[model samples]
Target: MTTEVKPSPRERLLEAAATLTYRDGVGIGVEALCKAAGVSKRSMYQLFESKDELLAASLKERSAAFVASLLPPADDGRSARERILHVFEQVQSQAGAPEFRGCRYLAVQIELKDQTHPASRVAHQIKANLTAFFRSEAEQGGASDPDLLARQLILVFDGASARAGIQADDLTGLIAPTVAALLDAADMR
Candidate 1:
């Protein structure tokens, strides 16, 4: 008979950390995360060696999931600009979902002042990856300076997130016009 082993302590800790950080932000303590994940502190330490390591892994996982969610599937057949706008649409869709707590990486960065920390490093990597993705898409859409366009789009993305978090309103209306202008400028250049 083939045996199926359940997920390990490390797997449990990673999953729990991702969930808690996404829902409650990164300020929650390690003990709370361990308890929520139903794993012992000893097991967590054994797997991660330190809370910083565990937090980094969790943030990495969350970052991957966030990017994946923003990307359209291969069959979507959308233009690059459309695909980019669709990302904003997805974010807006999540606004109405229960318990939406805003972007996980942003939350972690805001909570941690020491940028040298492991979690902060992971967050910085995530932001870089996201910015690169935007640049690539902009280039594919024929933007003259994909790098500059990507930076501008990132500003719009961050501004929209901030508006949503602070005003509890969808900011896509403001974002869409900015993206439209960007696309128009790209066509001109």
Candidate 2:
């Protein structure tokens, strides 16, 4: 017989924060988070310095899976243009999910509204890393202006994510062509 070990209190709390904050907003209070995690407020504090720290840690913990969900594997042998489009294709698929709520990092930044907040900083770094990925891919694709192309890609990504998140746009015929145009304009192969 195999015994399934339950997650520790700390892991449960992190899971709860990530799920609740994404579904609801960062406005979710500690009480609700503890209830979801089945942990006590005292235990929550003992595991984390504060709610902000918990939020930050949760974001940090999920960063790897988040990036993997978007980014193509490193050196997959696809052209730069193909790699870039892979990201948007992933976004469009994710948006089709019923639980999609735009980008979590973007949501956190919008809700916190304080760049210096611990969670805000973590969110910022995650986005910056995404932009950096675009830049690197742009350079590899031989874009006319890698920086410009990267910025344009991130803008489209965030815009598409936000719009689809709110159900304002299905992105059915949108993201792919828009990204292709940008890549074409940048003269990327």
- Best model per TM-score: 2
lDDT for each candidate structure = 0.78, 0.97
lDDT of 2 by residue, 91-120 (tens): 999999999999999999999999999999
- TM-score of model number 2: 0.98
Evaluated against the true structure, the overall lDDT of model 1 is 0.78
For model 2, what is the C-alpha lDDT against the true structure?
A: 0.97
Q: Which pairs of residues collide in candidate 2?
A: none
Give the range of the ten consecutive residues with the poorest summed lDDT in model 1.
163-172
Per-structure clash totals for the candidates: 0, 0
Highest lDDT: give the candidate number: 2
Model 1's number of clashes is: 0
